[model samples]
Target: MQLFAIGINYRTAPVALRERVVFPLEQIKSALQALNATWGSNGLSNPHAGLPAETAILSTCHRTEIYGAALTGNASSMQASMDAGYAQCAARWLSACRQIPFSELTPHLYTLPHSSAVRHVFRVASGLDSMVLGETQILGQLKAAARAALDAGALGAYLNRLFQHSFSAAKAVRGQTQIGAHSVSIASAAVRLAQRIFERLSSQRVLLIGAGSMIEVCAAHFAAQRPHALVIANRTIERSLKLAERTNGRAIALASLPARLHEFDIVVSCTASVLPIIGLGAVERALRARKRRPVLMVDLAMPRDIEAEVAQLQDVFLYTLDDLGAVVQKAHTQRQTAAIQAEAIIETRVERFMRWLDARRGAPAICKLHEEAHRLRSAALARAQQRLACGEDPKAVLEAFSYRLTHTLLHAPTRALTQAQDEERARLVQLFGISA
Candidate 1:
């Protein structure tokens, strides 16, 4: 069995590059199905072909990663060559999925195999690898990814075990350590960006593009500032109105965004749209409407509710997940001790998880060996009992049984040794611990 992972994260690539690789939630299941086709739908590995039988993809604003396991019909039988080949295949799949050139993706990509891959996932789920250390959002993100792969029938035993272990490890990390004890940076990140763009957040008109939990969190933070005007917009006016009532802001339909886009000085969007909702053309028209007055835009969606091209507009300052991560990373210094404890917990869990994985790898061979031994023992015992029952001498029957059992046990090894070549003979002798 071989375990492999290939990915690029915020630490390795900037937001500009990250957005190009983001997988929309609606398309994740289909993407996984397409990638797993190389291996076959029945979840069996073809040793001659290096494609992975079990595969999953996790894509967030900060990272896009692929995790895979390839198990041969022969239990736990995988080679270094096979692992390396599959790693490259996974990378190519990611590149193709996002329509990015391999040459461009290679420099930023990180590929991990076996224990390293398992450890990487453990760290990610625990938030140790996140831009904001101990932020719990990553765990939710991972669960979402796992669900998508499972729904698509692209995930199986090896990956299933890996993710379940990850979840348990994360729980242990969070429960035993003070990793998430501190205040979260998520609520303040947008406000910080807004402040940077304008001299005073109080003077800016704020428009929040979604009424989900994320928008609620941001609304509270922005409400504390009491901006000049606060507006909530959603596909449904009722939901927006509820959120707007709390923030003492008014509600607007999402469709009204295009007409009134230029009215707001700050726009924060975190909708669940699969495609870009705020296009470059829309922002451009807004900029023209405002006579090129600067507007701060924070796009918190995974697939990006705001268009990437919007960042290029002269008067629009756009920030993505990676940008927000920078704002949160600074707060990590105060929680260094808690993070240290969490890392230690993760390390212990990672070792335990790897042991479980190793045991799984060895199971097929172990079962076969046990079964073969049991069959030989049963046959020998039956023959011995029959001879004794026929009134043959008891001692003779026992002796004969012992002789036959010994021969059966030694048969395979003796035959192998007899057929061995000069070099093979030396290795076989050492393997069986046979004296010279």
Candidate 2:
């Protein structure tokens, strides 16, 4: 069997492309089932006809990756396929699933096999791959992905173990290293950017667009500043109410944003919407109403909740994900020493996981050996019981039982050793731990 990870990340593709492939939380389970069906069969149950019997997908704002294990197949064929490019089949599946052209998506794809896949996941789980270095949010996002795959029945032994190991590795990285020290989350960074424009957040009105985790975090950060007012707008009023209750803010319908746009001094938006929600026209009207008063806008969405044209408005300071990336990059450099230490920890865990994987490959042989030993022992025990029932002396019966068990256990090794050539004889000697 071969383990692999195939996908694209923020490091590989820009937000424009990454957003195209994102699997929303509600769709992840169905996506996994579809992927499993395309791979043909379960490799664990029918090794010859399947690829990636076990599969899990990690889809976050920064990346969408498929981690899987392909069971018994033609070694040469699989190797040749890997050499040609290991990600083609999976990438094709993703393109079809996400409705993107393979040609357009292939350039940004990365395919890592076996150990590389293991190491890549370990690093990802440990926050080594996050845009904001050492951010803890991705770890939770990955766990949610694993849980979704499990619910879909797509996760098998290999993937289950891999995710468990990755989680433990992440815990170790967090507990043993200083990678998280003084770390800046994207939400806090947005707040920091807003602080740059407004002398004090206490005097500014803040509006959060969307009720997702990013927006929730931003709400908490802004609330701490005791903003003049905090409002949460969401497609669902229930969701907006829930978030607003927690942040001690007011809930508003997302449809009312344009009418209320000029009311807030700062706006932060992150949503699953495919198209931009805030347009230039709305902002222009809002600006005119506010007498051209400056407003800070941060678009944390992948495809961006704010229109690109909105950034061109003179009275508005709009920041997209790429802008936040640049801001976080400066914080990432300060933790280089801790990150180096964390990488070392991840490497050790990767080696340990690979060793466990290698042992799993020999499981069939080990099971067969166990079955054979059990058969011989049972046969010997039965004969001893028969002899005793036939009225043999107790002492003699016991001695005979020991003799029979010992001879039966050593018979095959003895015969093989006696008839073996020099090399085979030496191997037998070592295998059976012979005296001479």
- The CA lDDT of each predicted structure is 0.84, 0.87
lDDT of 2 by residue, 350-381 (tens): 99998898888888889998899899889988
Worst 10 residues of 1 by lDDT: 73-82
Q: Report how far residue 19 has shifted in candidate 1, in Å.
A: 2.2
The whole-model C-alpha lDDT of candidate 1 against the native structure comes to 0.84
Runs with alpha carbons beyond 4 Å of true place in candidate 1: 39-45, 48-51, 72-84, 196-203, 238-242, 245-248, 279-294, 307-316, 388-436
Winner by TM-score: 2
For residues 92-187, could you state the per-residue lDDT of candidate 1 as single tens digits?
A: 777787888988887898878777888899999999888878878889989989999999998888898899999998999888888886645666
Best by lDDT: 2
Global fold similarity of model 1 (TM-score) = 0.81
* Candidate 2 weakest lDDT stretch, 10 residues: 41-50
* Candidate 1 local Cα displacement, residue 224, angstroms: 3.7
Point out where model 2 deviates above 4 Å.
Answer: 41-50, 73-86, 245-248, 381-401, 415-435
